[model samples]
Each structure stands twice: as structure tokens, then as C-alpha cells.
Target: MEMEKYFRVDKLPHIWCPGCGHGSVMMSIVKGIDKMGWDPEKVTVVSGIGCSSRAPGYMNFNTLHTVHGRPIAFATGIKLANPELHVIVITGDGDGAAIGGNHLIHACRRNIGINVVLFNNQIYGMTSGQYSPMTPEGSMATTSPYGNIEPPFDLCELTRSAGANFVARGTVYHLPKLDSYIEKAFGKEGFSYVEAISQCPTYYGRRNKMKTPLEMLEWQKKNSIDIKKARDLDSEQLKGKIITGIFAERDDEEYTARYDQLIKSVQGGKE
Candidate 1:
């Protein structure tokens, strides 16, 4: 496929640091969207304040770069107004799981028709280097000079448990499969989520001793375990491994459709 069709050429030269995994992940998203053959004008991209949020600006779509941690709320409104639109949210670990955690949970619980692609780099890259909700325990950051003491949130597990119709996990290293997951999410009728494990070489890497982006990617390649492979291994064998794969899929009536039905019933067929 000619990649130019999927991007806004004027937005070339993205601001993400060199060797950062965000570029590959963004490409995978566009590839997935292209495969789905959704009309560009009908696709809406929403995002909160973060590095990942910058993606919507680079894409040729109806994009909304919203306030910190509130993209889902705004997206909910958009979906309510026009259920036909394909709404996708681009968020970071800090933006989605910290300040916006409440909204994320409610979005999953409501099973709204929106695809959330969480770019989890494990730290607040946009703000220099603060520890985020997905930062692994004992990882170093500017906020956690010694090591991060808080436990990380497993996004897929959380979303699946919260009733999202579909949830999947993938790393930038597994980009082709990541594209597949995004495509699957976009096709689902209810709330869907894909957590794209990204690498932040500029901030997270420098603070965490991953001197170069390649080193961080190498570590990811070595530590990540496919969910299928993980099931075969005992807990002891899987210690400290990153599990990547589809974690859940359910067919639920989307919130917008159900709400419309309720309104019709309440109005007794009146306008």
C-alpha cells in the first residue's frame, strides 16, 4: 500500500525523539485503519494531553486533541451525537491510567463504541520523566530516583475485567500483530481497547539506564512473552515477562445503540 494515503504529508517529521517506538506504532494503526477501509472523513481520532495525543494531529481525520485525561469523555459525547462515526482514542499511560483512570474504567464499563489505543511507555515522557501507572515496580524515573514503588496496571486485564467488548495487548516489536489487534478492535461493535507497549528513549530510557533506544528494544524483545507461550510456562518461568496477546472478546450491545432503543421505547414512537 502507498503509505502516503494514510498520513497528512504536511505533518511529516513527527516530534517524537529518534528511535522512539511511537512512529512504528502509529504506522501500524494507520495500516490497520487502511485495511478496514473506513472512509477517512468518517473516522474520528481523539486524544488527551501527552506525547501519544500528538498522533491525531498527524493523521488525516476528524481529530480532537482534548484536555488531560478527558479524551474519552469528549469521545463519548461525539459517539452519542453520531453513532456512525468510528471513534478512536490515542492515550498514554499517564494520560489514560493516572489522571484519566476513572474515565477509562467508565468507558470500558459502558461498552461505548470507541476504540482506545493506549500508548503505554511506562513513564510521563511528555513531562520529562515522572513515574506513570504502568511503570513497572522498581523502575527508575525522575520522580522515583531510587525506584518506582507503585505496582503497574495490566491494561488488558483491567479493560477486560471492566467489560470492554474487546481487549488486546501488543508491543511495538510485534507491530504486524499489533495492527491486527487494532483492526479487530475497530471492527468490534462495543468498547474495544489495544494497549501498545511503546518505548520512550528520550526520558524513560535515559532515567531508567537504557542508554540507547536499541538497548530498550532489545530488552523488550528478550523479556516479552506471547500470551500463548506464557500459558504453557509456569508462573515461576514467566516471572518478569511481558505478556502480549488478545485477552478478551465479547459481543455486547453497544451503549449508543441501546440508549437509542431506550429513548425510542420511552418516547412511545414519538419524535
Candidate 2:
């Protein structure tokens, strides 16, 4: 199967800054789709407004570039309309967790069959480097010259609590592992969430003195731990660290699957 056939170059060159991790995450998504050998006509990529949201435009499959922080809503509608289609929502930290946070939680609670690839760069790369909800406290950003005052949300914990059927996290530096997690997410029957810890060198790098995109990537490589071994670490050692791998998974009926069963039962009433 030719992978290039599913890409759309007219939207290029991509808007992401040089050496941005979004490109790496995008490649993982493409690789996962290619591995699945999914029919392009049966796949729909949806996104909200942000650098990461532009991802759907680069794909030749059915795409929707919706308003900021609304990709989940659009994806839900699309999936409910035709549960057979593979619906993927590509969103950034700000788009998925900040402004669109409510939608994210509700979608997970619904247990809908949709795949969400969250590009977590930690800061608001777009909109001029503000402190996003995922930005680590004490991390410097354009808006937080001194340091970010608020704590960052643990995305994995949040999703798991919201009832997501599958939750995983991987960084751009861990491409092989990231690809595997994404592939698993695609196969899940209910809401599947994969958080890609990406780097934003142009903005986040300059603020943190990482200076270069490669340096940021190296930082992630050193700071992240495989989830399987995370339990061995002491609390102090694990603080401010990221655990990467499949964190939670459960096999259960999706929203539509349960609904279909209910409809059939009602239609075949014995009374």
C-alpha cells in the first residue's frame, strides 16, 4: 500500500516551526494508519484550531478543521452518524485540555468509539506562548515571565478518571513506542486517548533555556519512564517526571454498541 497516496500536499508546507515535535507525532499517526491498511474512504480525521489542529488538512481522508477546542464534539457527531467509520481527533494541549476540557471529559464519559491523539507540547505554542493548562508549574512562558503559577493536569489520570476505555502516553523521542500506543488506541472499541508529549522549540525552548528543539527532545528522553517500571520509583524521584506507555485499558461496550443492543431489544419486545 502506498502511504503517500493518503496525504494532501496542497496544505503544505506545514505551519509547525522548524524541528517542532508535532511533525514527529504526525508521522506516527500516518504510520499507524498505514499499518492498519484502513480504507481512506472509511477514515475521517478531525481537528480544532491550533498548530496541531492543522494535521487533518495534510491527510487525503475525509477531514474536518473545526473551531478552536471543538474537535471532540465534531468527532462525536461523525462517529455517532456512522459508527463504522474510523474517527480520529487531533488536538493540542490547549485545544484539548484547556478551552475544550469539558468536551474531552464528556467524550470519555460517553465511552464513544473515537480515537483522540492529544499533542501535548506543555505550553500554548500558538497564541504567542501563553501558560496552557498543561504547562508545568514554575515553567517559564511568554505570559508567565516569572513562572507558571498553576499546577499542570496529569492527562493520563484525568482521562482514566473520566472513563476512557484506553489511555496511553508517549513522547516524540519514543517514536517506536508512540506508534505502538497509537495502533492500540485505533483498535480499541471505546474512547481511546493517546497523549503525545511533543516539544515546541521555537516558543517553549526559548523560554526554558533549552534553546534548541533537539535539546528539548533529549530532555524528554531522559525525564520519561516506562510505565511498567514507574511503580519502582520513589515519590520524590517520580515528581515532575512523565510515565510513558499504556496506563489504562478495559474491554467494554462502546456507547453506540450498547445503544444498538438496547434498540434491538426494544424492537423485539415479547409483549
Candidate 3:
């Protein structure tokens, strides 16, 4: 199937700012979809309010551009209504981890069969640069003129703890590896979470003096460690480190699977 057939060019010249890593993420998703050989009609992409949210509009599939911080809820509904469709949620740091945090946690806890691609640019790119929940401590943002006073949430750890069946972390610079992770997530049967550490060159880059998107990419490359190596690092050595790769995975009953079992048991009791 021709990949271009799945794109909506009217939304052309995507809304993402120049040098934004969100573009890389968009490409990775497209590539993953193609590699999976998924039928576009059988797939649905949902997003909330953010640069990442605009992604669903550009894709030629069943799409939902929902309210801010609610893509997970929408995705959940769509998946429950038609469990056979491959549902993917595109969300940003603020939209997913901050305001939408409750939904994110519940989705993971339910082990719903949905693939969530979380774009973690650290700062809120669409809201004129406020510090997001994943923004590192001491990082400058519009809200943090001096620097952020609080520590950031480790997204991978949060999702894993919430009981997501699959959890992984990757950056735009690691596109090849990220594509593989995304494919794995799509193939997984239960809640699959990917925190894609991306760059917001316009806001996050300028404020932090990362200056350009390339510089931010370089930072990610330098700071990120393979999961295996990260596990071996002592606390002191692991400071300021970003671990990339699949952190946790397990094969367990998905939400629908458990539901089916309950129905069967109830039917047997009735008989």
C-alpha cells in the first residue's frame, strides 16, 4: 500500500514549528503503521490539544481531535466500541502527564488494548511555554522565569507502576530504534505506553538555551543510556541520566479478556 495514500495534505505544512521534533515523531508513527501493514480503515488515531494533537488530522484514518487532556478517554471509548480497531493516542507532556494524568493512570491500570504515543517535550509548546509535569527541575519556562522549582515525573516509571503491560522510552534522535519500539507497542495486546522524549525548539529550546533543535537532539543523545546500562548505574552515576528502551513488559490478560472471562463464568452459573 502506498503510504502517501494515508496522509491528508490539506492539513499540509503541518502546524509544528520549524525544527520541532514532533515531525520526527509523526514520521515514526507513519513508518510503524506501514510496517505493521494495518488497514487504515481499521485504525483510529485520537489526540488532545497540543502540537502533537494535530497529528490525527494529518493522518487519513478514523480520527478524533478531542478536548485538551482527554485523548485517552476518547481513545478508550473508541476502543471499547470497536475492540478490533487499532486505537492510537497522540499526546503531549502537558496534555498527557499534567492535566490528563488521571486518565493516563486509569488507562494503564485497566490494561486496555490501546497504544499511546506520548510526546514528552518537557515544556508546554502550545501554551506559550509553561513548565509541564515532565519539565526538569531548574528548567526555564514562561511560568518559571527563574527556573522550575519542582522535580519532573519519570514517565516510564509512572506508567510501569500504573500496570501498563508495555512501557518504553525513546527520543527523536533515536528514530530507527524508536520505530521498532512503536511497532512492538502496536503489536502488544494490553496497554502499551511510549514516552517519546522529543524537542520543542521554539519554546523549550530558546528558553533553556538549547538554542536549536539539533542542540536539543545532541543533549538527548548524550544524556540517554541504554536500559541495561542504566540498571547497572549507581544512584550517583545515574543522576541527570535519561534511560531509553523498553523498561518493562509482561503478557497478561487485557481488559477485554478479563471481561470475557467474567461473562463466561456468569453464564455458567446461570446454566
Which residue ranges in model 3 land beyond 4 Å of their true spot?
268-271
* Model 3 C-alpha lDDT per residue in residues 1-271, reported as the tens digit of each score: 4646788877788888888999889888888888889999998999999888888888999999999999999998888878889999999999999889999999999999999999999988987899988898889999999999998888899999999999999999988999999999988999999989999989998998899989999999999999998888897787667889998799877987777678889899564
The model with the greater lDDT, 2 or 3, is 2
The all-Cα superposition gives candidate 3 an RMSD in Å to the true structure of 1.6
Q: All candidates' TM-scores?
A: 0.96, 0.96, 0.96
Score candidate 3 by lDDT: 0.90
User: Candidate 1: what lDDT?
Assistant: 0.90
- Residue-by-residue lDDT tens digits, candidate 2, 72-112: 99999999889999999999999999999999999999999
Q: Rate the local accuracy (lDDT) of all candidates.
A: 0.90, 0.90, 0.90
For model 3, name the residue pairs that clash: none
Give one digit per residue, the lDDT tens place, for model 1 in 1-271. Answer: 7656667878889999999898888888888888899998899999999999999889888999999999999999999999999999999999999999999999999999999999989989988989998998889998899998887888788999999999999888877889899999988999999999899999888877797988888878898988888889996787667899999999999999999999999999898
lDDT of 3 at 20: 91
lDDT of 1 at 182: 92
